[model samples]
Target: MARLLDLRQLDLEQIDAVHGRGTSWLYPLAAAMSGATAGIVISGGQLATATSAGAAAAPSGAAIAGAFVSDAALVLGLASRSVGHISLLYGYDPEEPAEKLFILSVVNAGTAASASAKTAALSDISRLTQSLVRGKTWEVLDRSVISQVSKQFSKAFGKRLTKQGLGKVVPAVGVLVGFTLNWTTLESIVDVADVEYRRRFLIEKYPHLANEEIPETFSDDLSDDADEAISVLNELAEAGGPDLR
Candidate 1:
């Protein structure tokens, strides 16, 4: 199965700040992701410190994320391209264990940017001095397409879409369409097979989710065709197989 590892907010070292957005965004995101995979453990490395008299430095998750990225490269091991982006790990916790939750906002924003900014961004990074730069590809998405699939999946799953909670729920809903898979349905509905729906689903489903009120500025971006397709697939699965759907 295609796994979307959640390392969104795990960067404790903040090393990527040195590289700027382009590739920097990649190191922290990918490293924590790879580390979360099977058998991957943190090295607890020390970060570079200011040039001063031997001042001891504390280890960081940022170091972990960075080391993990390096290790994956050293092993000459790459995830199957068919796996697509291999999940985008993000978020960085301030405390220990560094609650490195994946920041879904970036992905949600990234999908839109792919249409409006992808070409220029890629061109700028590649230094490909050319005028024919195309690929403002996100224009292909339509509201109906997004709403249709969104509603379809909602009906199938029979779950209510409310506010942005926090932790798991926040990240899960935001990144539902990040990759190509059935995560939407997988996360949307909870099995009613148990009593105490609140305990089994809401309160316990993802206990870390914040109780913050839904942002007044909320949006359901179904304008991206890629997002829409993934949404439909997730709904189908959540609704149940042919026996259920």
Candidate 2:
């Protein structure tokens, strides 16, 4: 239990350090491009890469929507890689089967669900995390459960894609809109991971309250940083102009 608690604290510290350092060049590059004179060239190239082979035959709007989803996935993948590092710090071997199962359990906990349903799932995952930390063998997740979680995640992703797609409709603002949407999506994915892990951390540390609800409030430290990052990205978007790039 002490080991679990220490690992949790270490995870939080590592996350803060990474965000504070801001080592990724993507955000800054995206911000700088907001005011680039070559906005059309850059946006066009991005759209072309994001779309399928039949992109030329598709309507311009469809192509742009596809680009937004593609870009969003790429951004989420980057965030996942960062979380993968934290998984290692938690003493999970990224390459081993048991550790992979542990990682998947945490990842699936973040899938979109109704408020009540999500709360219940979080509680269940908190328990599972405790078992894992205590060195219990990992039980395979039910196929039906996996399917349900996948469907929920897909639904959530679709909703976000639709919302961001709307912003891409206006040609003149497409570049800035794309950057903002991608940044926001990335932040959201990271937030969900943070919440999921933090919940498990709390449950492991406070076994007395293990049966009680672990509120989202417990994860506010990470969420606050996510909010700040989103604000910074938005400010950068607002500062950049098509003429400047």
Best by lDDT: 2
> Going through the candidates in order, what is the number of backbone clashes in each?
12, 4
Error of 2 at 98 (Å): 6.7
Please give, for residues 89-193, the per-residue lDDT of candidate 2 as tens digits. Answer: 543445443343334334333332344434433544554555655666433434443444434444444453445345554445655665665554444444555
Off by over 4 Å in 2: 1-62, 94-136, 139-159, 218-245
Model 1 residue 214 CA deviation in Å: 3.6
Off by over 4 Å in 1: 1-20, 23-86, 91-206, 216-234, 237-245
Top-TM-score structure, candidate number: 2
Q: Write the per-residue lDDT of candidate 1 for residues 172-208, one digit (tens) a residue.
A: 2222221111222111111110111111122222434
| Alpha-carbon deviation at 228 in model 2, angstroms | 26
Worst 10-residue lDDT window, candidate 2 = 224-233
List TM-score per model, in order: 0.18, 0.50
Clashing pairs in 2: 35-244, 35-245, 36-245, 37-245
